[model samples]
Structures are given as structure tokens and as C-alpha cells.
Target: MSAEATPLSIHLADDAATALFGEDLLLALQIGDCVALYGDLGAGKSTLSRALIRALAGDPDLEVPSPTFTLVQSYDLKIPIAHFDLYRLSDESELDELGLEEALAEGICLIEWPSKAGRALPKNRIEIHLAFAPDGGRTLTIQAPEGRLSRLRRVIEIRRFLDGHGHKEAHRQHLTGDASNRAYEHVYPVDGSARLVLMDAPKRPNGPPIRDGKPYSQLVHLAEDVRPFVAIGQALRERGFAAPNVLAQDLDAGLLLLEDLGEDGVLDSEGRPIAERYRASAACLAAIHDKPFDREIVLPGGHRHRIPDFDRAAMKFEGELLLDWHLPWKRDGQLATVEERTRYLAIWDKLIDEISDADTSIVMRDFHSPNIIWREDRDGYDRVGLIDFQDAMIGPAAYDLVSLVQDARVTIERPLMDQLMADYLSLRAMGPDFDESRFLKSWAIMSAQRACKLNGLWVRLKDRDGKPGYMRHLPRTLWHLTVAFEHPVLAPLRNWCIEAGIELPESPA
Candidate 1:
């Protein structure tokens, strides 16, 4: 990390604004973070720290007495934090005596008057300086190390960006994110109306080339920035689809201010899949796929983002994730031998092009339940709102249709899947060139390929990334793959599964 990285600065309008700033800071705080707060007496350092601690504890009314006398106030919250008052310390050595060093290693530490501790502060700590304003507000200057606090820096940058764009006093509330590194916040304006979603999708480096000297992301045409999102989103909205309106954007920085699609989705209160919503979502896919699209889309500022084709190599890479990640994890480190590996690749090599699209229509890779927001108040297809479609590609329309009916996250009952597929096909029948048999075959092939990818991806998320939340979906993935095999197009995949000793879960009777 370079010391030359720019520092972040933010201005506060009042005490409430300072508290809001503190909440924003806490969004980036993790265990082992040391926030060195520097400010003069009554400069609202403690006030900001108090708000941060309270937000972490999830108690707005939690009493946070100053630790001036105690020197340290420890909270037994979700992530244990230590609040330290270094004002009365005699020298830097007192930090050790007060166990501040140990607390820094154990949990997050917020230190007021960090200058009193002098050089004892951690080198990678986030440094914040506050100053009094004549209007009784505060000015906060924040400096975070480049790599460690990159997300923190991006959060503040996005906040300031929004502030400059008519959301200066918008209140931010955290929204649960997916397994990806992206984070979202619901931004409510000061007037308490018109909420927006702030997407803090910082640009990430492409990993080392995994196959054929190309990174997996590049190979699969994964979205590396917000441009694909903006382009694909505008294309969808322009076609009268329910893709969110991009209120504002910072494409290079991977930040976006998007319209809040509200909390309603294609799921019930108990979180089961809603049949009506799923049918409508399937119809939405029909509407999108039936249209003609171009590989290259022109975006705002005269910039062009070309949608990549889901070609032969991309399909092969996805299919191999089952062998590369999931199979090894499932076998407890026992990997496929050279023969099994050859057979797996050979099968995909033969069938890849059969399922692969030839730059047909946009296939939003993740058109599943979780990404579909069901706005009941909207008219017609608008009720099925789309989110998380940044990784759009020019693929077979059947791909997104398979994604909708046979979702990885939710169990679409066989009847529901059948009904949704029927609903979808009926809509496509309205078009002139709809080839029913080929499209159904595409559905089968795409469904099988998707199941294989999900199986491997969920396992990779758990075994490689140390996230076990995806384990619960493994059975469903296998079951979906088994269902796909009922179609003759996936016979090769079924045979390979048998040869590799990959047990397909039995279909529900």
C-alpha cells in the first residue's frame, strides 16, 4: 500500500450530520480496525464515536457515557469494540498499561485524542480529524491506508458523490448483501421521501489467468465495473422492462445511485417461492428475450460497452467449476484422475456449442428469485423488477428462461417449473421465429449447465471462501441437474456424472 494514496475528507452540517458520518464510517469498520480520532475538546469526536458504537450495537437509545475517567469502555456487542479516551494518559507507555495494545489486536478500537498516545497508534489505522465550525457543525478529514481501508475510502467517496448530487443529507441504512463483495445501502433523503439504493461496487483486480492465459472473469465476460450495469440497465429500461433507473453513476469508480425497487419480491413472508410472481417473472424473461439486441450497446457519455458472447470456451470454463472446485471438496480432497478429467472436458467439448448461443439475445446470468423484485403496484411486466444483472451476456434466451424457472436459490416445484415454462413458451409463441423444439432443447442443455456451475460455485463459496451459507443449496442443484437429464440433449452430461461417480439426487416422488 502506498503512503501517497489520497486522503478522504467530508464535512458535517450539524451534530446529527456528524452522527450520520459516524454511521457511514462504521460501515467500513471491521474487527481489528483501529480508528484514531483526532479533535480538540468538544469537537464532536466522542459524539461521532458514540453514534458509531450505538449503530454497531444496533441500539439507538444505548447510553454511551464518556470514557474520560475509565479510560476505556468495552462493549459486548456483535463485534466487540473498545472505546478509549487517551486525553488523560501521561505518556505513550500508558497505552500498554491500559491494555490498549491487546484490545487493538482483539477487536475494533476507537481512540479519542489519539495524539496523546502519539506514535503508539497502529500504522494501518484509519485516521480521522475533526474541527469545530462557526455554524456549530464539524469538518472531518479521514485518511485510510490504501489497501486495508479501500472499501472504507470508497464508501466515503460514494457518500460525498451522492451528497453533491442532491442527496447531501440522505440517511443511509445497511441492506444485506449477497456472497459477492458488493455492499448496498438504502439512502433516504432528508425530506423522508424518495429512497435510493447506493451501490458501492469498487473495481476489483482480475485474478490470474485461470485458463488459456485469460482470467475467469474475462473468459466469462464478467462485469469488472459499473459500465456493463449502466449499459445493460438502460437497454432493459428502454425496452419497457423493469430494470432500475440509474439515477447517477461513476462508471470508472464502480459506484451507482439506483432507484430503490422496494422490499417486495417473488417470495412469500415465510420465504417460499410465490407462484404468481414466478409466472410473471418468467413472462418478463419472455418479453426481454423476444426482442432483437446488439452485441455492442452505446452508453451515456458516448461510451460503448460491448456485450460478450457466451461462447464455447465460456461454457467449458463454467462446466469445469464442477470438477475444479465442487467435486474435489465433496470428495474430501480426492480429485478427478486424468481419465475422469479428460472425459469431463471431452463431453463438454462435444456438447458446448450445442448449448452455447451465437450472439442471440441478452441472458441476464442471474434471473433467479432473489434478484427479482415483484412490485405488485406496477402494471403488467413492470411488476417483475430486475436487479443484479450487470453480468449480462449475449447468450441463448433459453439460458435466462432456465435461470428463472429452475432457480438455484429457491425450489421451484416441478409443477411450478412446468407451469412457468409453459407460461414463458406461450409468450414466446407470439413471436414469428420461435422454434419450440430447439428452444426446449436449449432449456434442457442450459439447465444442466447451470446446475453444474451452481453445484461447483456453491461448493467453492464454502470450501475455498470459507462461507458455508451456500451448502444448503447443493441438494437442489443436484436435483435440478437430474431433472435436466430427462431431456435427451443432456444425456452426455448424465453419462459423465455416472462415470465420475457423481451421485445425482433422486427426483421427488
Candidate 2:
């Protein structure tokens, strides 16, 4: 742990000692600001008021007297302000007589014992509570509107700067023994260095991510081919996508230290639905394809192909795994006929051709539900983040869209899909080449390819790893395949899968 990584705690002791605490709280004051100070007598309420007035006036001597029986003490400061001690006021009339509202309209006003003023004070005000600590110190609690959280963050930054340094071991103590096994373990301090969060991998580390009997899941070791993943994230961020910034990476060790976006993603706490987070995600996709990605940037992920073409052989080979492993081995006691397997391969070939020559942009190869993180703020693409982006490539523009709208993990409401697509089209004048008639055909073909690919992945995860829970997604995957195969343009392929006994699972299960 380094001193820079230490947590922050907002501590204040006495009114006369406010200068030693720092300028963070004082600098946060502004025009039309009403601050309600809460504390018992000798709790440093007047002390804080004096520090605030001196701060605003650029007074080095801190020449400010107690208002006590005088009620209000006016100050000719850099911002034309007034400091009032309303602790002695017995009635609301005394507050009105102080001209608080008038002063607020023209300049900054700092009010002590503001509760006595009641409705006379503005609702949009800062509230500060001071309490004596166990060791004769003071703790201050500041509250403001949600919009001010950013400004407050800035104040926090300054406070940290003034504190010199903090206890180093406190940060290192947070790391668990299992931390190295996960990707992205970040330590960030909060609450003025009083607490810290050790963010692990964004997604749960299900089990050891070993491959081929070797522990290959560590993100620090990067194959040369995988290096492009970092560049793609940088590019997407430049274009405005909620992609995670790489905090640190040890490519040789396959370890990646990354920023933690907290526990916010498309899914809600109840695990029921992924609504209220689709709009921004849709916008990000729209933005990616809004302007043709700079042709100069080299696309990454696969070596055999780039953004414009599909690896038909790879798709065909992957599609066969679905039947070879997932479907009942003996579909009611006999192997699938050679004719059936060949026909499905032909379907894949045709669909690949349909999108092979289409317009291309960056396609986050698996832009499905799990890869997206939801936020209702500006952090996400609008509040939705794009994760699992290492496999991104330049491919058909429809690839990512179909992946998002027709996700196999979760079914999206049809109306929502309609609105998202309409929103996308309004932003992008797609092109004469991408008319509705052509788009539907291309969408069906792409959806078919995606569905077939997912079904194969389920089989691989299950038979190869004994992970059977993934079987649940099979039915939904089949439905998407069915939708694609049944499209008017894909009717021939649809009938062939049925005749070949593909045996797609029953959905709505």
C-alpha cells in the first residue's frame, strides 16, 4: 500500500482550529447558498462561521467578531456576503428582519441556527452537522443535493491534498488472498480516507478459469493477438462508450488491474428484468455506427478475417458442435442422417453470404446481455457499459444490434425493441443500400448465425466442463434460431432444419 492509496475521513475539532482542517469546506460555499449549522453550544458553530467569513473575504488576519446579542454581523467580502448568527433569535420575525432572502438574491449568505428561520430559508441549501469525537476532535457531516455530488468529489480531492499523507498499511490490508485469481482488483478510498473498497472482477469469478489443464484465466498475460483488445476499448471510449479503463496490466502474467464501476449493470438487484437501462445502450450502438469507424485503425481479435467478411468455415464448424454434442445423441435412437447435417451447413453458408458483403463497423462479437453493465448516470454508454469487448471486430453493422435486441440470455419486450431500432434509425440515415426490405432479410440471417453459435457454446460449456446450468439458455437460443429460420427470406433454411431433425428445444419452458 502507498500513502496515496490511503482512505479519507472528514475530521474537524474546534472553531478556532478550522484553519488547520483545510479550505475544502470553505471553498465549497457559493452564492444563493444557505448553510444550516447544527451543534450544541461550544460545538464550534460560531468557529466554523468565522472560518467561512474569513475564507470568503480573503482576510489573512481572520478579523471577524461574534454576532452574539447583535443578532447579525455584516461583512464587506470579496463576494458581497453576510454572516448571521441566529442562535439567539426567539421568533421567526427576527429572521425576516435580518434581510436573509434579500441578501441571498444578490450575494452569498451564511446562516448559523437556520432552523429558527424555518420557511424563510431556501430549500436548496447546504447542511453541516458538527459533533465532538471520542478523542476531543470533531466530525463534520455535510449534505447537499444529488447534483452537487461531483463538486463534493472535488472538495474531497482538495481535502486529500491538504491532509499531507495517510496510513499506508490500511490500504494493503484490504487485499484478500484470492485477489490475484480475479481480474481487476482495484483499491479506492472513500469517506475522506476513512474507508476503502477493494473491487474485484466485474462479473463473479464463477470457478477457476483454467483452460487445457493450465490456469490461463489470469488477464495479465496477453497473447499478441489479444493486445488489440486494449486499443479497441480506447477507441470506443474516444467515441463515448462505457468501457472500463485499464488501471494496470501485467501482460506476461495475464493479470489486469482495472477500475471498478461498482455493482451497477443492466440487471437489477431482484434479477427479474433489464429495463430502464436499454436506451443508453441503444445510443452507444447508434453512435458506434453513426460515423464509419476511422478506416485507419486496425481492427483486432481474429487473424483469419477482419471487419468485412465472415469465416464461413468457422461458422459451419461451430454450428456442427450444437448437433454433435447438445441435441440428443440418438434423436430417438438413430444418428441424424447425413442429408440433414449437410442441409443445415448449407443454411449457414447462405446466411454468411447475405451479410458477408454488407456495410461494416466495429462489432463487439458478443454484445449480449451479460456483457453490458447498467448505470442510470453518465458513466455507462449513457449509463450502460460495454464489457467482454476483447472479441470486438469490424463486421456487419447488424451483428451487434441483433446481439443486443435478440439476446438469448434474456428476452426483451417487442415494443422496447421497436422503440430502440426506431431511435437508432432516426439517428442514422442508414443508406439506400440498407432499406427496410434488405434490413429484415439481413437481420434474420444474422440472428440465425448468432443463435446457432450460442447453442454450440452451451454444448461446449456443458459436455466439456460439466456445467449443466447453462442448458437453461438453450430453449431461448432455439427460439431466436426459429425466428431466423422462419423468416420469409430464410424459409428454405427453416424447412431444412426441421426435415434434418435439428430438434430445437421447446421455448417458454
Candidate 3:
């Protein structure tokens, strides 16, 4: 806001004219920085003016067409830079009438053709003059009091667009798919509410690739899904579910701070074993199942990727991955013929169709041991907290049941799995429909789908993202697969894994 600030110079000799304007605008400014333009028509004033506005708006290709008729076109820059083209001003007094002064007071302003409003302008405004040359080239002169154009000048000298600071730097240092990449974890000071856990999404570097890799990519790095996750978290809290309260989200920065669960998870506080506590831990899952949300909430991309219908192909691929990577690798290269693979796939397809046709319910896809945290408030054993459910979906209720009963981390005792299922059905008041025989059959089919997909995912994770530690969980996942496949309900699939030579672990819970 001071005219004493310094002004930086940039050369526009070659095709670097537009690039110079972009670089200058992005680097030299923040929200609420103001700029003024001075030039003749076709003097390249509009060209440089457009570039500057686009940079602040987070739109490098933003088309800031002259507001010939509108006179003023306000822009909501990533910060807040506004652009005004006053070529159509009927008179110099028209400037004040248009409230141009107010926009300047509120944010950084860019005014084109300042001469049209000469005496009506501010006292300490920066001025840029563009005049035509004999050869049709334009000479631009930027003049301001010593401090007037300081920020804009500084931006022009920046070596990078974002200039790489704060959250941007954190992302570059942290974001990665590498297993060795330590999970970006933080413990926050307790605020009167339940303890909170905050996970900083690994910060990605500045540029185009942030949006390119796993799910989707874009020039922007904001976590597009954070909004829905926030909505669901709020909804769950309203329902009295044990989901952590999402405290705050800097979606543009992919940062979320959540309420922390205590050190005690389903596994253990120190991650050691406590055999006697197993039954109660398993019962906590039943408590969650008692409260199912039936409302369909709008998510990012609207509902294109809604559950059940959305995850069907992904679900089928989960089974296919078992056949594609894990099974073939486990067999040590004993290959199957094209016809044999086709026939085996039909079995998985049939099972998936049957499960999909079942009554749909909210399915917490990763509702297993690692996700549940223990809390002391709801009594030691029943205080299980759920996390890692950014991918919740609508599906057969049995899917998440299998996630817990046939956990990937360890096996559940047959008696315990049966007891948990019985308890869950009873709590929900479904005595007749929750028949043991029918429940177990649904559980087996869903479990097989989850297990195969999980194993396949690990393989893909290792091969694609360089995260090899997930491969260790593959053996247990195969054990679950074998158990589910062996049931008469999944007998056809069990025979496929057997003939394919994928070894199933014999470990018992």
C-alpha cells in the first residue's frame, strides 16, 4: 500500500512477453495486491494485463477479455486480484460513479487505460505506459512511487511460480506413495473434546504432476474429496457414531486436522497382543452396525462414483487382480490358458452379481482391525473408533462384516466370528432374516471378493508405487481368500485358486 516500495524490471523482447507477465504476477503478489495499467489501444497493454490477472487467479490460461461493454470485470483470483477495462468510460467522472475506488480499497486492482480517468484516480497508484513504436513494437514503462510496485516487482524476479513456501514446501517434503515414506502423522494438544488424530496428506510438489498420479490429476493440488469427507464426518457425528470429528480442512492444501482416538486400537496400545480383550473388541463392530445411515449424500463429481453401482467394476477388478497378479505369482509361473482364465472368471462374476443383487446398505470397505481405535470414554472395551473410511460406499451389509471377521492382519476364531455376526444381527432386530446359514454364505462370498481385491491391490501398490511392505500382508489375505473360497457357497472359486496353485495360509486365530 506504500509508494516507497521498490519496482522490479522485466524484459519483453522475445516471446517471453506473456511468460514474464505470468511470472511477475504469480510471484510478486498475494491476495489484495493492486496494479494499474497505462497504454494505448493495441499497445500490448491488454496482453500484459491479462497475463498478470490470470496468474493471481490460479488460471494461467484464464481469458481476461477486455470488458468493452461491461467496463469492469472483477476476478476472484486464487488470492483476490480484480481487473477493470475502462475503455468504454463515457467521461473521466464516470470512474468514481463506477465504484472503481471501492474495489481498489477491498483488493489488489488492475485498471487498464488509466488515462481515461486521469484526475479521478487515487493519489499513490502505480502506472504502466504502453506506446507504439515505428516498427509496431510497444515500449512499456512502469512507474510508481518507490514502494508502489514493490510486490509486483518482487514477483517478476521469482524463479518459480508458487515460489515454493509454507504448505507448498511441506507437501514437496512429505507426499509420496513409497511405503518407506513415514505416514505424515501428528499428535495435537487436546481441545476439551475427544482426543484427535491429524494426518497431513503427503505434500506434493508444485506443478502439474500433483493431480496426475493415482486417482486423477489437475493443475491444482486441492484434495477434491475433502468436502464430502467433511460432510459425512459431520453426519456421522450427528448420528452419534464413533467417527472422529473433522476439525478443520485446508482443502487447497490437502490438510485435515481430526479428533484423535487414544493409543488403544483394536490391535493394542503398544501394538502387542492381549488375547482376553479380543471378544470385546470384536463386539464393538456390532455396535457400529446397529446404526446404519440410509440417506444418499452428494459427493465430489456429484455421484458418478457412488457406491454399489460405482464400485461394481472396481469390485469385480478386485477379484480379477487375484487371478491377474497374486495367483500367477504364487503359482511360480504355472500359467493358465485363455479359456481356463475365462471360465474361472465367470465364477467370480456370478458371485459378485449375487452379492450386488442383495439388499444394499452402507459398507465401510476398510472396516477392519487397523481402522478401529479404542477409547476409554465409552467404557474400555466398547469404545472402538473408526478411521480410514474416505472410501465408504453403498453395498451389501455383509461386505464390512467380512472385513472384520476375516481380517487381513490376523485370523478370527470361528466361534468368535459366529458370535459377532449373531450379536450384530440381534442388535439390529433382524432375527429371522439373519439366519446363520444365510449370513455365513453371504459373508463367505463378500469376504472372497474383499480378500482377492486386497491382495491384488498390495501387489499393484508394490509394483506401481514402490511400496513393498504391503506384500507382507498378502499371505494372510490369501488365507482369508482360501477360507471364503472353500465354503460350498464359494466352492467354485476355491477350486480355481487351488488349480491355479495360490497357496493359502493355514494359520488359525
Candidate 4:
């Protein structure tokens, strides 16, 4: 171990504390981690291991038998786990027969009595030493490599946050995480009556400057901290929308305890879009756009979050993702030539100019299915719960409509998408000064722009981030792009894509 590796000590007052520690540790663990437990007989090693395994299984009452006699116990879970008791091993080489290497390769391995394995143990494993405390409790000292220690410390910080907020005994279950660094958990109270969501979004550091001494996120106006979410969510809730109420927050820490909006989304159990829910969501967007909104929102503690404009530069930067990532990935690392890229940017420049005078509103940048929730028990617009709107911008209202009807993640059939567009237009038309002709043109431009961004974003996620699962949405996004090109405003871009050998479905008659 490196000399810089420091030991973190904790007091476990009882079994509950140990179990909570196990759950906290689960948040920090990833695949290929090895945790070596050192403790004397009946020193609470078994308790901690069992709690961790049960938490990983997401079943608190799961039966986790001791592996003392069997030597090893393996579980196939969300992330597979292998529990090993090295006490019975006669030689260090016996680890080979026990599949230690294979276990470490696939998932986490928790080893008890690791001293028996001697030098065969992993060099970078986390070491946890449990001992009896003078006050009749257990004291645990943990030492881990720097990378793991950082994550562990973050998890502990979150635990302390919860403890301060009167949820010291709440159960934390991993809910969902997105492509960004933000993660969420369902916090169930001890009484199990109601659940809340814990948003763990640490303030992101600025990346290497991609353009004009600013990172891509800054150029595109992405939220770097939780302030925008708090401000926007409060604004939405005050407008009587179903944005979750912020219960507690640590602004600097980027943590928020939010009202749980329930699990019912706009998709059916089979993941197909429900037309009624989609229509409701469209109507909700129309309602949001109809009202005149304030650009500068005052947050709690007298802080202000001024929404940024989705300007021409931001749109161009996003559209260039297609050239930067998608084309290279599709063409086997062949980048777009300077001439081709110039032509592409010229086309987008004209399109953005055309939409410059279009109707503007607070654009929830990602108003798609994944970010929407369905609240059937509510009525009208309240039935559509809005989540994940931290990246709000003052932009063309039609951009959000395109995001909805041409959802990148799911296939919105032509008929349904048309119906949704019509419904949204009719609703907007009811308001004063609505221009369908101008709105349609802006919608077409934004649709193509968003499709370009997503097409490259999916590839970038796969190649750069090692998240290949996002590639599954490539065909859907491509199809959406083809649909967008069906608009007369996008004809030039369509021709450019064709000349560049970008495969797009034929525009329908």
C-alpha cells in the first residue's frame, strides 16, 4: 500500500449502524473491487458481510448463510458478488481452484480471514479491521487506495447529510443514474409510509477548454451545480406544475432531498409510449410556454440563477457533435473533412438565422420521455410530472416540442408524433399571437439540430465514456433525423448528409 493511504475509523454502536455502513459502502463499490475483512471470531465481520450482500441484492430480509464451511458463496445480482472465507485454504495456490481471479474479474469479492491467503491477496484491496470497543460496541478502521477512498468519503458525506436531516434511519435504495455524473436514490423512512429521492450531483469541475477558453458544458449552458435545479424546480412548482419539491439541500455539496414523484412514467411496462400520457406531457409543455416567464429566478438564501439563452453559438456547438463523434465512429475513424464540415456549419447557420425571430420561452432542454413522469392520480397538467429540468434555457419554444415528438431514446411513430404536434399546436394557438407557420419552421430546424447533437452524443458515450449501451438508441435517433429532414426547411441539410454518405431513411412522399 502507498504511504499516503490513510485509515478512516468509525464506531458501530450496534447492528443497525453496521448495516447502514454496509449500505453506504455499497454506493462506493464498483465491479472488480476486493474487500478484505480482518476481525477475530465473532467480531461482527459476518454481520457486516451479510448486510452488504443483502443490500447488494436489494433484499433486506435475504438469507445470507455463513460461507465458513463452504469456503465461498457467490451471488448473481445487479452486480455479481463473491464472498470467500479463506480460513479453510491449506495453501495460497488453493485460491486458483476457488476461482478467486475469475470472481475479481467479474464483480466484487469480499474475503474473510484474508491472512490465510498470505501474499496471494490483491495488492490494492480495501482493508477493513473490526475490533471490540471498550464501550461494548464495534470499532472499524478502513484503509483503501486513493481512488476508492475518495468515493468512500463522498458516500460517508451523503450519509452525514441524511443524518442531519432527520433521516438517520432511512433505507437507501439505488434508483437511477443518467449519462451525467448525477445519481439518485430512493430514501424510504423507517415507517415505510413515504419515500423521497436523494439527488447526489456533485459540482462538476470545468473540463479542458473546447472552444474560446470554455468547456463544452459552459458553451452549451449545462448546469455545473444544483443551484439551477433548485431554482427551476421551485419556479415550476410555484407555477402549479408537478416538479418535485425540494425538502432539504446542501448547495455546496450538491445534494438535495426531493419529493419522490413515483415510478409511473409515460411508458408502459413493455417500454412502449402511452399515447394519452404523451399527449398530457405535450399539453404541459404548451402550458409552460404560453405564460410569460422570468429569466432571472431568485433562489433560497438570496442567490440568483439567471437562465441562459440557447444562442446560435450553443446550437452550432451542439450540432458539430455529429461531425466530431458520429461520422468518425460510423466511418471507422474517418473524420469529416474541413470542406464537408464547413458546408454543414453553413447550412446550420442559415437554419438558425431563420428561427432567430421565433417564439421564445423557458426551454426545458430535455423534455423527452425519460425525464417525464406520469401521475395518473392527478388531473390535467398535474398528471404530467416534470423531473430533470436543471438545464433550462431561454430559447425557441419549438425546440422543446421537437424534443418531445422526436424523442431520441424511443421511437415515436409518425402518426402519434404528428398527433402530438397537432395537439401542442392547437393548445398554443389558443394563446394570443400564435403563429403556426413560423412555429413549424422553427420546429423543423430544432428537430434536425437536436438529432445531429444526439447522433454524435450516442457515439461519444460509447467510445469515449465506455458506455456502449447508449449505442442502442443510434438507429432510433437516426430515424428521427430522417423524419426531421422531411421538412422543407431541412432539405439542404438532408442533401449535405446524403453527399457525406450519412445513412438516412428515405423521406416519405
Candidate 1, position 365, lDDT: 93
Cα lDDT tens digits for candidate 2, 245-328? 765443332334444544566655765446556666777787777656553344233323232223554455556665665554
The global Cα lDDT (0 to 1) of model 4 is 0.90
- The digit string of per-residue lDDT tens for model 3 on 40-136 reads 6666766776766664554657777787788888776445666677777779888776777677767777778767776777767776666665554
Q: Considering every candidate listed, which one attains the maximal TM-score?
A: 4
Location of the lowest summed lDDT over 10 successive residues in candidate 2: 170-179
What tens digits encode model 1's per-residue C-alpha lDDT throughout 386-456?
Answer: 99988998877888888888888878889899999899889988898788888888788888889889889
Sliding window of 10 residues with minimal summed lDDT for model 3: 167-176
Clashing pairs in 1: none
The count of residue-pair clashes in candidate 4 stands at 0
lDDT (Cα, tens digit) per residue for candidate 4, span 66-121: 89898999999989999999888799998999999999999999999999998998
Ranking by lDDT: 4, 1, 2, 3
Predicted candidate 3, C-alpha RMSD: 18.5
lDDT of 2 at 186: 27
The C-alpha stretches of model 1 lying farther than 4 A from their native spots are 1-14, 36-41, 54-145, 356-360, 507-509
Per-model TM-score on C-alpha atoms: 0.86, 0.55, 0.56, 0.97
- C-alpha lDDT of all candidate models, in order: 0.84, 0.60, 0.59, 0.90
**Candidate 2 deviates by what RMSD?**
17.7
